[model samples]
Target chain A: MLEIRNLTASVGGNQVLNGINLSIQAGTVHAIMGPNGSGKSTLSNVLAGHPQYIVDGGEVLFDGVDLLAMPPEERARAGIFLCFQHPVEVPGVRMDHFMRAGYNAIHKSHDEEELDPIQFDRILKDKAKIVEIDPLLLKRNVNEGFSGGEKKRNEILQMAMLEPKLSILDEPDSGLDVDSLRIVAEGINQLRSPDKAVLLITHYQRILNYVVPDVVNVLINGRIVRSGGKELAAEIEANGYEGQGEALQPSA
Target chain B: MTTPDSLAQSEYKYGFVTDIEEETAPRGLTEDTIRWISAKKNEPEFMLEWRLRAFKHFMTLVENHQEPKWANVHYPPIDFENGVYYAAPKTNPASLEDVDAEILSTYEKLGIPLEEQKRLAGVAVDAVFDSVSVATTFKETLGKQGIIFGSFADAVQEHPDLVKKYLGSVVPYTDNFYAALNAAVFSDGSFCYIPKGVRCPLELSTYFRINAAESGQFERTLLIADEGSYVSYLEGCSAPMRDTNQLHAAVVELVAMENAEIKYSTIQNWYPGDENGVGGIFNFVTKRAKAAGNNSKISWTQVETGSAITWKYPSVLLQGDNSIGEFYSVALTRGYQQADTGTKMTHIGANSRSKIISKGISAGHGSNTYRGLVKIMPKAANARNFTQCDSLLIGDQCGAHTVPYVEVQNSSAHLEHEAFTSKVSEEQLFYCRQRGMSSEDANSLIINGFCKEVFQQLPFEFAVEATRLLEVSLEGSVG
Candidate 1:
């Protein structure tokens, strides 16, 4: 569903992602693990079309479309969802209204009829239960004054509402407690389908225990150095990246 | 002159005028003109005498004064001698039903239905065209509730005692140049009174439109809420497009007696000049409300999005013990418009309180300024005041400024003021766009969010209307 070829990105003239290549197919979960300053978050941001990150060279193809040529909103409408590690707190925009706007934009882009308030509300209430996000949170301003855990859960709730084709969870488990982690994992599991793909970016294996990935890629020095199966994640958790020196080898 | 094709493609929707018959006064200011206006309105002899006195004062003030240049405003010198001082609706209606159809259609075009069934519920309307009161609806119903709802002319005639006692008592003729001009040649506005111990049953609204070319609208509105009474008054203004800049100098005075409460709201959407600042209304107004007697309260809420050059300060005199005063405003300036607006709150009584919240949005080459003052007199012991002023700039070409003057004579007074000015950040916009909102939608959402604090202060219906007005006012630039 997604393809990246030699993606070299820079922000403020500082190269953040240098010649990184990756691919993901439908119905598969991929995990990208890296230490601090390893460009894990930058990869997610560049894929979401953040204007600050200038793609110096290379290509990103989503379902055979030129993803790099699209604007951020067009990318979102093309079913590319980025769950921010630090969710933005947008004051005065009610969560329900924000969700409806996101839903309508994607739905309209795909030639689907938009849902009215009544129909949308009924669907949102049921989805809120799976994410363990209180329905009352939808009435308040989007993520305003919410705790860190609540913000992460809110992002998951949005991900559920959008039902994007390629979902990038950027450290979604960083702020979640044990129970929230399980709930977020359960929500992702429920959203799994044959036509959807998931890319999980994380620093710990706690979340991987709940939503196991089919493949794990170790990112270092702005490149994907190694790719392996789920056992690679377990091995990295047991012995830190210090012992896995081969995984740090530069990829051609 | 710009081609019609060029001007026709302009996006200002309310820049057109309606054709109607008018009885216009000859251009120029003189004792004769004042007397002519008094006679035209069939004013009482005493009122005529007062107008003559004001006219004399106007002549003295104009002769001794040079045009004040300190207001941060630039406009061609107003040729007072070549401007019409008064114009009244020639069609007099014995009842609202007998009103002129063309004039009624003008209101209808503005989406304000004059018919009772289609009128805004529980809101009495006093419609003013140019310098005359065309019609006042719900008069009988308001009168049954012991409310005085009429034009300023009628108030001067039937309720001379009340008019004479309160007129200029709060804002004297010498308050400013425009105040003096308004006092000398003011033609018409609304006069509302809620009797002592009686709560007004409905919202009192007045709509002012400058429909005549070269005609200056100098309207004076006075609203009095008697002891223990409460009233809410709303004012709206608009003007037709004219190459020669038109002047609109209005004065509004409000009085809240002991235990009385008054809420005055204004939505000023007069014609702002073209993008290059060619033509529009030059609005210079002086509006003040005094809270007299103990436990009185007065509040001013305004949404100002129009006028080529707007200079107005809606103020409050908190003279009543434990009185409360508030000013909430959202001023938007697009194209070449310039607005210097805010409020002044004076605390003279013990335990008085005041709150001021001003939000300004500037786009294109527009300039938005917030000039406010809060004064606590020596006698106002333990008084409190809070002010928050925020400005949002849409484009780099625009400017936003804040100047607040605070004076606290009482050692026990507590006052806090905060001000911030910022442009919409690219990061914020990108965040919303990443959520599937277009740049225009993102900008509008951010602007609306920035103004939510002040917009929420308006009544529910007015809030909705104000939001829509903000959206419409920010159309071209936001996209």
Candidate 2:
């Protein structure tokens, strides 16, 4: 469902994602793990069409469409959802209102009927249970004065609302506690289906225990150096990627 | 949507005028013109004496005015003597049914259908054309509620006791140059009075339109919410395009009695001139509201998107214990328009509180500034204030400035002020684009998001209207 060919990106004239190439098919889950400043976040930001990231080379295609040519909102409407590491605090924009806007934007693009407040409330209430989020929080300003765990769960709630074709969880487990991690994992598991893809971007192995990926790719210095099955994640958890010289430059 | 080039060539939607205009004083600012206006309005002896005093003060203030160069706005010198001090619609019927159809049609063309606007605005409307109130709607219904809603001229004659007591009590004759001028030659504006303990059922609305050339619009609005009463008032303005700058000096005074609440909202869309700044209204307004009794509240919400040079500061005087004041504004200036607007919150009572939220957007070489003041007097112990001013600059050529003055004399008073100025980043735009939005849509979304805080303070209907106005005003320029 997604393909990246020799993606080289920079931010403020500094190279961040260098010569990165990856591919993932529908109904598959891929985990990209790397240390801080190793371009893990940069890769997610570039894929989500962040403006600050300058794409110097290569192209990205989603479902055979030129992904790079679309704006961030268009990309979102095209079913590409990015769970921000740190969700933006949009003051005065109620959570339900923001979710409705996102849902309508995507639904309109997909030629689906828009949900009114009543219908949306029913759907959002059910999804709220999956993420263990308080329904009352949905009525307040988006992410305003929310705890770290609440913000991460709100991100998952938004992801569920959009129901994107490709969901990129960029360190969704960063500020979550054990309970929140379980709730987030349960939310992702419920969202998993035969027609959707998930890209789990993380640096720790704790989240893998709940939502294990079908494939694991080790990213270092902008490039994915290793690609293997679920066992690869277990192996990396036992022994970090410090001494895997041969796997450092694995074939894309 | 029309292309930028087409819109630029299109004539203003409200460029027409009624031909039935009759009475008009000769263009000039002198004792004779002031006397003519006072006499035409049939003012009392004391009122005429007040006008003469104000006219004398206006002459002195104008000489030392110095044009207030500090504001980032420039306009051609206004010929005080060349402006018609008073121009009432030719036919003045005593009732709405007697109002001229042609003049009413002009209002209909302006999108303020008199009867419908009267219902939507809630309070009686004293619609002003050029320099006079053409018609007032819903006066009887409001009068039945024991609320005095009518034109200032009518109030001066009918409720002389209240008018003489409250007029100029908050803002004296020498308050400012514009206030002085308004006090001198002000033709007509709305006068509202809410009886004690009565929650006004309707929103009072006043529509001001400048239809004549070189005619100054000096309007005076007075709203008094009696003790324990509550009221909300709205004012809107627009004008025709003209080569020569037109002076618009209006004074609005609001008094909230003990436990009363007064909300004043203004959406000023005066003629802002073309990109080259050829012709526009020089809007110099003085609006002041006073919390006259304990626990009274006053709030001001304004969406200013027009005028070549707008210099106005709607202020609040907290004179009662635990009084509260709030100001929410979104000022947008584009294409040679300059706006230096904000509010002043004066805390003079114990435990008084004030909040000021100002959002400014500048594009197309326009200059927008937020100049606000928060003063906590020595007696205002335990006073609290929070001020947030944010500016969004669209193009590199435009400028956004923040000048906040805070004075806290009581050591127990707590004051916090924060401001931020930044151009929308390309990164944020790209992020939205990647989500499948057009560049224009993304810019609009971000701008709207930036203004969400202040917009939320508006009434639900006005919020939607303000958002649409912002979108239309920023169209074709959002990159």
Candidate 3:
């Protein structure tokens, strides 16, 4: 459902993603494990169409469409979701309104009838339960004064709301405690389907323990050097990223 | 996808002029010009003398070059002599039916229904068009409650004693350059007074419109809430688009008596200049309220999103024991607009309190500044004040500034002031965009969030209007 061909990207004039090739079919969860500064977050940002991350030379295809040619919003409308590493705090914008706007925008792009507040409220309440998010948190401002765990849960809740095809979870487990990690992983698992895909980007294999990935790839210096079954995550978890990139393919 | 930059370049929506025959005084601010305005309104002897006194004081300020350049705004020196001080529709309307169709349609176009049947329920309106009150609705209904509400001209004619007692009591003619100018040539504005112990039955509002080209709108509004009374007043204004800058200098005064409470809200959408800042209204207004008796309260809430240059500070003087003053403001400046606005709270009695919340949004080359002051007198023991000023900048080219001055003479006074300046970061914008909102929608959402506190203070209808106004004003401000 998604393909990346020589995806070279840079931010602030420094090349971050150097000559990367990856492909994911439907109903598969792919894990990209790397140490810090290994461009794990950069891959997610590039897919999400962040303005600062310039595409120096590359092309991304989502379901045969030129994904890189779209803006952030269009990419989102096209079912590309990137769970941010650090959720931005938007003070005074209520969680319900923010979620509802995004949900309705995507729905409208698909020529679906938009749900009114009352209708959406019921659906939101149900989604909140899937993630075990307290319904009251939806009344507060988005990510303002929220605990790290709550922010992660809120992102998962948004993912549940949008029901995107390609869900990129960027370190969703980084700041979570054991309990929150379970809830977030359970929520992601509940949303998994045969026709949807997940790109789980993380430095550790702990989250993989809960929502086991179908494939695990080790990323080093912006290049995915090794691809194997789920056992590769356990290997990285034990040995770390050291000597993981010795088989790096030369850049095109 | 539609680029927001081009969308923001849309023309000001309320820029259409009303083609009506007007009776205007000669262009200039001479003594005779003031006399001509006073005669045109058929003012009493003392009123004429008052105008002359204010005119003399204004002339002295002009001679001394005291046109208040202290504000963080830039504009060429105003040629006071080249502008018309008075411009009113030719036929004065004794009733809504007598008003010209053109003038009435103008109000309808501006979303203000002046006709009785079509008027907004639970709200009384006074429509002021270019130096004259064209229509005032629900007069009889308010009069039955002993609430006197009408035009300033009518107040002087029908309730001379009341008008004389409080016209310049709060903002005197000697207050400042703009106040003096407004006092001298002020043509028409709303006059409202709530009787003792009577809560005003309806929301009273004044809508000011500048329709005639080259005419300066100088309107003076005075509202009084007698002992134990309560009232909420709203003011809104707009102007037609013109290449030559027009002047709008207004003065508003409020007096709240013992146990009385007065709430004032303003949604100012005066015409801002073109994107390049060619010409617009130079809005220099003076608004002040006095909590004159014990336990009285006065609150000012404003959403200012118009005018090329705005220099106004609605203030409150807490004189009675345990009195209170509050100011909630949201000032949005886009394009070439500049606004230097905030408030002043003066604590004169023991246990007086004041709260100020200001939000300023600057986009394009706009500049917004929050300049406020909180002063506690030596005798005012245990006075308290809380002030918060937050500014949000949309683009890198715009600017936001906060200047607060606090003076506490009493040891028992407690004051807290918090300020923050935040840019609409790319991260936040991108996050919203990635969630399916367009860049423009994301920008508006973030700005509305930043201004939510102030918007909550507005009346429901006005809040909706203010939100839409902000969206229109900040269009094309973001990529």
Candidate 4:
């Protein structure tokens, strides 16, 4: 479970997230739909503890622990995963090597037995299949020269491997084709469980058709304006984010 | 007692000086110093004549003030007369057992155990302490295979013919100012020779340690692979922390005969001074390998992570038809360290080929430069060379430069060059950190990836040590 109480953040001296308040229960998928510059990505970055994003005001708690105080790596080890909109290219860093380092790091922080290369390979291969990622790509550098669809699928693969408690998919469907989008949606659907939560941040409602959300919240100007069922996604799709903030009351 | 802050501040882990009585030549570089070094080694008359000739030439260069001002590095004029030319542990060890415990412990502390039981498997080591080699492991085993592996001083006495024939054959003493200086006062280094048609059974290594303060270590390493022979040689250099700069002018020459192959790797970790860069070793080295006969091959793999100022170019002279030359280097300069290193591939024989891959990493106020040359003569038909230079900067104050010169007189020659410079982006760092790695680990991971190509060229154990060395060298380089 996670709780955000009037969380305000800024980036590069510009206030982006203006007192955002949201609460997500375990096992529920929450979709935050907003237009560009509405601070959807800012919220995701602030929650993941990105260094550039300063917490200007308010507080965020993950399992009753202060999330804003932890460093990015500590937040990651504590099971907060943010699938980047554009994954960075880490030249010469093999995907498997990077993943294994992350896997062992998180495991060690939790006092769990770490998996060696051989043991980890089996788990990686199985997870790769669930995400429909070509195993050959795992031998190459991380996100180096990866196509748009492949990058999204790679992020899903990492999500599957890390098994985070709260997964923030930031524009995962942004540069994907129909077939790639279907695969990403299916991967997310397969990763859903009663002990986990998914916060899907997107500007488009197309992905909502594939992995329907339990709660759909419209974010306008860094604040959640409307909260409704999955039908709210269809409503937004039919009538975009324009004038939605003025029409709907702020949700508690 | 060292705090974590001090440890990170001065990441030169091998900065400890061995406390032992030493026999040092009087401070200064003169004819008497050369004679003392030659007499101390008991070198043959021909060897002494060569040293005198070199010393005379070195004096001429000094008179002309030709201290190689072409390189893009800045330093105060060196005080040659104020530094000791030779400084060695007092006792001369006739065998491993006779080696002084303090000297042996110095090697052990450096992770290079001279004891038989703790010796690294398949790596015959010759531990050079200051001016003389104190211990040579697996000498008998190597000798049984008609492979002469021992100290250069011993080779001058035992295998004078081999030493005389190949010495200065690739990098002549007249080649440069430092080469002449090294040839004149070079105290001792490893000497190896593989007989015809023999592949050396194990790796040959030389570990040079500079413990005596205010002494310059002039090491001369010569390796010869006879016709149809093969050998892999590696050299490691380090020095203690000092307030005054020490000089390390070394010359390494390798000869690969017909159908022979020679592979040379170096892990140079001399002291890079404190964060303020007050004192350290000035490593001026000349390393060259010659493919003397048709179909021979020579490769140089180096990981240079230390030294206050490094100026060296490990080159390959492709004199034989169909010969191959390769240079893989990873030069990392942190703090105020400066490195100007690369390679030269000269194609004199038809169908000769060479490949160069260099990675330079600069952190703090460090400066790194890759200055390489690829030349193909008019008579050399169908020669080929491919070069790739990549530079990585960790902090804003650091700098990287790539200067590649290509001269092709033959129209049939084919050459290609690629160079790229990139900063350690904040996004890359955040990406790795978000994957659960600490900032240090993330920085190291990114650097290791950037250096993967060069590290893979090293031998297994050397590769592992080189990786760890890069990690240590990059300490405190980032927040």
TM-score of every candidate relative to the true structure: 0.94, 0.91, 0.97, 0.97
Candidate 4's C-alpha runs over 4 A off are: A249-252, B1-8
Give the per-residue lDDT digits (tens) of candidate 2, residues B1-479: 22223223213445555666567898688999988988888899989999999999888877876445766666666767567888777777887778888877878887677754344554456788887787777777888889998788889999999999999988887887778888999988889899999998877888999887757889999999999999888888888878778889999999999999999988888888876788888999999999989999999999998788899999999999999999999999888889999989999999999999999998877899899999999999999999999998886777898999988899999999888887777655654454445666656777888888777777677778778777877877666
Find the candidate with the highest DockQ and give its number: 3
Q: Tell me the whole-model lDDT of each prediction, alpha carbons only.
A: 0.86, 0.84, 0.92, 0.91
Per-residue lDDT of B201 in model 4: 94
lDDT of 3 by residue, B1-479 (tens): 34334435456899998988999998777889998999999999989999999999999998999999889999989988677999999998778789999998999999998887789998899999999999999999999999999999999999999988998999999999999999999999999999999999899999999999988999999999999999989989999998989999999999999999999999999999887898899999999999999999999999998899999999999999999999999998878899999999999999999999999988778899999999999989999999999998766778999999988899999999899999888898899999999988998899999999999988898889899988877766666
Per-residue alpha-carbon lDDT of candidate 1 for residues B1-479, written as tens digits (9 for 90 to 100):
12112222136666777887888997788888888888888888877777777777777766876445677677777777567899867887777898888888888777677887788887889999888888898999999988999899888888989998899989988777788778878888999889999988888899998898878899999999999999988888887777778889999999999999999999999988877788988999999999998999999999999899999899999999999999999999878889999899999999999999999998887889999999999999999999999998876777899999999899999999998987777777777877788876777788888888778877787888888888888876753
Q: After superposition, how far is residue B37 of candidate 4 from its true place, in Å?
A: 1.8
TM-score, chain B, predicted structure 1: 0.96
- Cα lDDT tens digits for candidate 1, A1-252: 899999999888999888888999999999999877889888998999887888999998999999999989999998999988987766667888878877887788788999998899999999999888889989998778888888888888888888889999999899678988888889888988999999999988889899989999988768888889988888889987764546555434
In model 4, the clashing pairs are none
For residues A127-240, could you state the per-residue lDDT of candidate 2 as single tens digits? Answer: 898888889999987678999999888888888877889999999999788998999988998899989999999998889999989999888888788889888888888998
Model 2 docking category:
acceptable
Query: Going through the candidates in order, what is the number of backbone clashes in each?
Result: 0, 22, 2, 0
Better-scoring candidate (lDDT), 2 or 3: 3
Question: Which 10-residue span in candidate 2 chain B carries the lowest summed lDDT?
Answer: B1-10
The candidate, 3 or 4, that scores higher on DockQ is 3
| lDDT score of residue B344 within candidate 2 | 93
Individual DockQ of the candidates?
A: 0.61, 0.34, 0.82, 0.81
Q: Give candidates' CA RMSD values in order.
A: 3.2, 3.3, 1.9, 2.2
Which stretch of 10 consecutive residues in model 3 chain A shows the poorest summed lDDT? A243-252
After best superposition, candidate 3 residue B65: deviation in angstroms?
2.9
Give the lDDT ranking, best first. 3, 4, 1, 2
